[model samples]
Target: MKVMRLPGLAFILLLQGCNISAPAPGPDFPTSEMADIVFYNGTVITMNEDYPEGQAIAIKGKKILGVGTSLQALATANRTTQLIDLKGKTIMPGIVDAHTHVFNDRDRFGLDLPGAQELLFKNGITSLGNLFCTEEFVAEMRAFEPLLKVKTSLFLTKTFPCGEIQDSWYHGYPATRTPGEVLRINGIKITADGGTCGGMAVSEEFIPGTTGLGDLWHTQDEINAMVLEADKAGYQVAIHAIGDRAIEQAQNAIAYALDGRPNVLRHRIEHNSAIRPDLIPRYSEFGIIPVIFGWKKICDFYPRSPFYEAADFPYRTLIDYDPDLPVAWHGDDPYRGPVNPFIELHSMVTRTEVSETGALCTPPSWLAAQTIPVQTALKLMTLNAAYSLFRDDETGSLQTGKYADLIVLSANPLTIDPQDIHGIEVQLTMANGEIVYRLPASGL
Candidate 1:
């Protein structure tokens, strides 16, 4: 009404005051009511007896929602779903390296070799039990978990750089009452000695006195205290004890801490190289898991270097005591080893050297008995390794409700000759329902 000749902006503001807000769109529904991804026409080795081999699988979010015949899975298929036609490839639970040092090396040198990760992935290792990791390295691994698609356990150390002592041969230093106290922290790694180096002629180079290195690393009292602290805090301890002396010390430490405890805590002894035949029974008695590095045949013992020792009984005695004692194989790579579990598995079953000359020299009959069956060896890398780390319930098998951690392989290891196991290539690796490594078309 010509009252004040309202400006255009003023009139629009007045009109806005009378407008009503429209109701929010109904909960922004998923674009399509179907699985985000599906794999079909594949031999899905679910690792579950009920559906061991399936024609297809469906995943939603980070879990395997469905596994069955391809026709059964097609009901949930949609145009938006990323369908993977496997063309009869073999699918198995992602391999787990029960004993590895990915984070440990990365922490020490900030080095990540493509060859190492590729070897592991190509051989189907999705999870690694990292022995000898510092808290700093553990933290870095936690940060990189999503990217690496590798799960890890902390192996606390009680040596220097982070602790005190070099090779555990010194004797005169004043013993702190709280010695090894810091080792109670998560991801602590402790070593009894410098592995086989203590037994070699070069033992003096690493540790001045070969015999005392074991005692000097940590006293019985010191190890017990650290183990008790770790036990109370719900942490598993992994000890690097390759020699018999170190193994005995580790066994004693575990028994001391676990006394009168109802829960059988998981404890691991890294390498278990040159284990005393008598001490084999002590592993099960103390409930200690031995994470053996199978690649040692090619990586160390066969090299015939200063550290080479032909007498080292990798697992014969231990297997005699308890075949089901839960052992896992590892490839301690980037330090004279390859990350391929298949190579290690082959070595375990065949006990043949990777080098042609060594393999030729070894008796063909003996090589056959050394390695475990294909299925059992697979368990060592998956279920047994998970059991060693106390993470079996979460992973270690391709079961519903478990994390969708698995790998697609070119062929079934069980169907092929154990010697030809290395030929099987990992086509795809998935962790948490997400593809992490996809094989290139060239198959390199």
Candidate 2:
């Protein structure tokens, strides 16, 4: 049999570095034609610094062609192209979760992949990082990705149960492997200490629950060695620190690791709650990202404490200290948090929660100062989240030449009441310029 010449779509995939399957583009191929799809007449949040708003957007296969006025964008399309009239709807970049936990077996942990897919797509969470995973688990998930709707970024761990590395792998982890663009291998996530509400935040402040001196699994030297080893292996370190003491330890270790070289890879603090006000600057100084869980409103894990104001979350303090300090949000599901982006968004801005049956969420008047602006809250689930996963350049915003990963919202959360933000629904969800999920009434 004679070998056939590769088609335009095959060549396109090779150029884009995407390994997934794709149908062949038409015979005209690349430059001969314009865009594959054009969406116009919408209130588009471009999310680009230069062009922050647009009336339309055009796409070519897996990449975004351009964003501009309806006339400007539509001019690039031909009769063969598919044009979608947004009817004044709101379109923004797809949501991302910086940190979360999931199991290998969907049945285990009562993990419902299909249900979770629908739940996330409906809420506009297009990409998420499973912060709890081993090489074995990520490989299984990667194999099962085609069957799922959402994109994944996996953070592989070298040490779990908060200890030293052995045998070049964790006790129960599989062999090491390189990661792809989407299946990102963001260094190790180690538990430096315990939770806050448990009175184990490693703080000097005492609590009824237990001794405030939380568990420090590794000393600064141990953490430094781990960071050095991980960095050498092409990975960043993510430490799970809550209390001031634990956060300090993490800072020292990371600082030592970054001693002689510039920090090109990102380091992070997972669940960075209960950090003292003075310790906040060190995070930005060290370029350590804090993957904050905004769904703390749903858990009493950080219930009213005399030591809560300056320590618990301290989102306001951090952003105020340095607005440029990158922070991202998470749902932290099946592990003491809600998996709803809306809930996280609302909670981050309102510092409140819905009732058990849902609805009837009231912002405690006393804690009103803790709330952040709507725009700031939106970044927690979008740009900042993607930045933490090193996928910001690809899917964080509605920018030209980026992947057309975006969502159509029923309403713009920026102008609406923060309390009502969680009520917003995703009218449509598109990943890689292709409609992946749409409401039945949408007629897509």
Cα displacement (Å) at residue 351, model 1: 1.9
RMSD of each: 14.4, 8.5
User: TM-scores across all candidates?
Assistant: 0.74, 0.83
Q: After superposition, how far is residue 230 of candidate 1 from its true place, in Å?
A: 2.2
Question: What shift in Å separates residue 235 of candidate 2 from its native position after superposition?
Answer: 0.9
Error of 1 at 219 (Å): 3.5
Candidate 2 lDDT at 369 equals: 64
For 1-444, candidate 2 gives per-residue lDDT tens digits of 101222443344336553322122111113333678877666677666666677777788887877776555555566577877776678889998777664333454465766666666776778887776766786677776776656676667655654545344632332233322445455667767666223345566545464546567767777778777776776767887777787888888778888856667888878877777778898888888888877665333334456655576678778888888788887776564445677677777888775445755554443556677878878878888888887777888886668888988777777777778778778888877778789878643
Query: What tens-digit string does per-residue lDDT give for candidate 1 at 223-320?
Result: 77776766665566677676666677777888888885543667677777666556778887766888886654442322222321322544654665
As for candidate 1, its clashing pairs are 155-188, 156-188, 156-189, 156-190, 157-188, 157-189, 157-190, 158-190, 348-371, 349-371
Report lDDT (CA) for all predictions. Answer: 0.60, 0.69
